[model samples]
Target: MNKGNEMAGPEKEILDGIATRSVYALGANAASTRYCFRVLRRFLGEGDVLELGPAEGLMTGLLQSTGRRITCVEGAEAFCLSLSARFPEVEVVQALFEEYRPDRQFGTIVMGHVLEHVEDPVAILKLAKGWLAPGGKLFAAVPNARSLHRQAGVIMGVLEAENALNDMDRRHGHRRVFDPESFRQAFLGAGLSIDFFGGYFLKPVSSGQIEANWSDAMLDAFMVLGERYPDIAGEIYVLASRPAP
Candidate 1:
C-alpha cells in the first residue's frame, strides 16, 4: 500500500513489537507497497535516493533491495535504531522532514504516504524538489479517497462519501485524503511535472478485514484489479522528475 495508507511491517520480526496496533498496520501494509516500487524500478536512475518517513521500513527494506544508495529521514527514534541495526549501509537520518537538510543532492526522492502526515504538503514538496539534482525522480504516493472499496462503501450506504474519514484513518494520523486533482496540484506547485500517474492494489475491503479473511492468491488478484481500475484503486501514485533546465 502507499505510505499514505500507513501500511506497515518490516521484513524482520522486530517491527511487530513496536507497532501500536497490528490490525491497522496490516491493512496499511496491504496498500500500494510492492506495486509502487515495481513501477518506480523502471524510472529510477543510478543516483542516491532519499526516503522521507521510512516508518516501519516495510517499503524501506524493499527500496534497499534495489541496490542503490538510500538515505532515510525518519522522525521516530526507535525506528531509526531499528533501521540502522538492520541495514547498516543505509544512512538513516533521524529528523522530521521539516528539519532535515542534507549536504548533497539526490537522484531520487520518495514520499510514500508522507504528505497526509505533514502539516504543509506544498512546503515539504518544495523542499524535496530543492534537494533534487537535475532530472531527479520524485515518487509520491498517497491513499486514494476514491479507492475501490471506499466507493463501494459509499454505494452500499456505509460510507458517506469517498472523502469521508474513518476511525482507522484518524488513528493513522492522516490529515487529508487525496484525489488525483489535489495530488496533482501539490506537484504542480512544487515545480515537479508528472511523468506518470496511476493507482495500484484494488481493495474490496479494509486491510485488517481482508488479512483476516482473504488468501494470498486473492490479494494478488486485487493488485491486478487495481491496474485495471486505478480510479478506484486503494492507493494512487505519481512518478515525477524535476523540470528541464
Candidate 2:
C-alpha cells in the first residue's frame, strides 16, 4: 500500500536535505544500527511493528527480517521513496510524527535514534505509548551524552560541554543529546514504565577516528563491552510499556 502524504515548503525541503546526507551511511553508524537491532530483538513483542524515523532504512532492513508486519512513519520524502523502493514489503507513510495517526495499534513501537532530532521527545513518546496495544512494548534509543567519546571531547576542549551539540551532531540534525538521567526522565514524563534500560558500543574515540583506525574485531568487541558500562556507552536504550490500568 502506497499511502504516502506530501509535506510542502521549507520543512519538507529541510527533511529531504537531511535524508540525502551521508551521515547515517557512515561505517560506525551502520555498525551501531546493527548492534542496536540486536539489543531491540529481545524486547520485541508479537504482531505488527511501527518504526519511526527509519532514515535510510538501516534499522528498517533489520526489522523486516523478523517476518513481522512492519509499518514505517517517516517525514522525509526522499527517505520514504528510498525505503519504499528498497523494501517494497514495508508500508511507508510519509508524514511527520506529529501528524501521523495510524488506524491500528502496534505490538512493538520503535523510536530508534529519534528523540535527539525531535522538537518534543516526551510528546512523541506519549503518542507512541497511545498507539501501543495491550502487552506492547516501546523501544527507543538515542546517542548518550555521557559517552566516553563525548566526555573525552569535553576534556580535550573540543566540546564546550558534554551535552553540547558538536559539528557532527549539527550535521546529523540532532537537537539535543541525552545522558542516562535525562533519557530516563523523558520516558517517565510520557508515563511509560521502563522495562529495560541499557546501552551498547563503548566508543573510546569519535566515529571518524574509529573508521580510520579500528578493525572489525575491535568494533565488535566494543559493541559488546558497552553493556558492562552503560553510563559511558556510545548509545543508550530503553524498553518501556504503558502503565497498567
Top candidate by TM-score: 2
In model 2, the worst 10-residue window by lDDT is 1-10
Clashing pairs in 2: none
lDDT of each: 0.77, 0.91
The runs of at least 3 residues in candidate 1 whose Cα sits more than 4 Å from the true structure, single-residue gaps closed, are 1-31
Candidate 2: where are CA atoms >4 Å away? 1-10
TM-score of each: 0.86, 0.97
| lDDT of each residue in 153-227, candidate 1, tens digit only | 889998888888777667666778898789888889888888988878888887778878978778878877887
